[model samples]
Target: MPDHPDTVLTPSASAAGVAITPTSASARPRGRRRRRPLTRAGSLGLNVLSAVAGILIWWTLAKVGFNLPTPAAVAKQAGHLLADGTLEQDAMASLRRVLIGFCLGCAVAVPVGFLMGWYPVARALIEPWVQFFRTIPPLALIPLAVVLFGIDETPKIIVIFLAAFLACVIAAFQGVVSIDRTLINAARVLGAGDLTIFRRVVIPASMPYILVGMRIGLGSSWATVVAAELIAAQEGLGHRMQSAELYYDLPTIFVGIITIGILGLLMDRVLLMAERRLTVWQERR
Candidate 1:
């Protein structure tokens, strides 16, 4: 008998009067191997190193007259903005807009997406509109939004809302549609009702897609808000950048850019954590 099912005995060894037993499956080396993932500390260290390297590159570019401000100069400008409460006010304004629009977008999107995915009638009715709107950039509607909703917070919020909505809805719709039919059939064969299958199988399987969509939507919201603020708005990082651009304030521009990046990164990290927590059963590299 072979040592294992996978083991093979060579005829040459048998002819030589030697029993040639191949290594057991457990003892044999694997054909493919995966590298160990970095520990949390190592990941953090790498992030810091990357940030440092980026700063060094930026400094080098600035020295080469690339019309960029040095990191120290940007930091100094940030301190000045902070001292006068300008940074805080601008940050709060942008944060409020993003939060409200993003939340409302998600609240509406999940249900709508679920409906479209689960019901053929809903999908037929809603999909065309969704695709049409998606092709039209949210920024392009800024003018219409302003005309209809006025040059207030409403228009800005509306634009952001649309951006987030489009991104999240598509993600959710794809998630639901992409669920394995075999799982649904299995559940049905086991005498599971539609509701039971939806609750137990569909929801869990679609969650990863929903979360990914939300992340994409969140990015879209930020982008839209900044663009919306660029026109006829006050008290936002985008508005501040616009104001700075008038006088060629490179340091202030850098500060605003860095602040927005940091805020977005922090929010993204929160979503990532949620994804990890909620989708623990999902395999990842």
Candidate 2:
């Protein structure tokens, strides 16, 4: 297209000693590159905002004459319990159970999942059972687990294990199965045997999936911990909550729920940090 008749195109040599060029998509400044998110700061801000919002709702509802306990009431109860060391006792016991069950579940799940995903015969045999049992809720099996193991640490641990095991197995198995076939082929072409391929290519490739499973399993573990401690538990958050419920102590109930939430959140962040550290070389896709 010719320059418009009204356009006073300057001569190349007479453009104030600078070369003039036609405008084009390439000539325009690229739109400012999207800035990377301030993830830590943003996360902190969001959590703070959530806390503030929750407090505001609590205050508002209490002021509007709701039967629910005020935030102060909850705070008072938490403080009273904390001062008497009751809170710590329960908290520590709960933490102990959670860690024990979670770690054991992951230890078993990861290896079993790896085998299932890595070996054809192993997978064919185990996948059916995994699928079948995974569909059952941890709570649903509580009756049987309790009856079998009794209302001791065994049953609670078993409940936690079920929660952790199912989630982790699924993640680990998926991670292994989802590995790039090309990567495996490349390794094989380079003379990597099946075992070597698994240890090298498969393990690294499946790490993200495994980490994701760990995160998910931790959440499920927390959810189950409450139920696990509901029976034959003398000093756990769940026991305290059940006791509170019997007396309609809403503040204690809220505190227990909040404690669980905070604990779970912290565990998740720790897992995330571990994942990032381990997978530093992998471009997060």
Best by lDDT: 1
lDDT per residue, candidate 1, 1-285, as tens digits? 664677777878877979666677687788877688899999999999999999899999999989888889999999999999999999999999999999999889998999999999999999999999999999999999999988789999999999999999998899999999999999999999989998999889999999999999999999999999998587899999999999999999888888889999999999999999989989987
Model 1 clashing residue pairs (backbone): none
RMSD after CA superposition, every candidate: 5.0, 7.7
Query: Model 2, range 1-285, lDDT digits (tens) per residue?
Result: 236433335666454665444666566699788677678889899989999998999899998999888888888989998999988888888888889999999999998999998899999999999999899999888889888978878888888988899999989999998988999999999999988998888888888999999888898888888987776688899999999999988999988887888888888989989999989889653
Question: Which window of 10 residues has the lowest lDDT sum in candidate 2?
Answer: 1-10
- lDDT per model, in order? 0.92, 0.87
What are the TM-scores, per candidate, against the unseen true structure? 0.90, 0.86
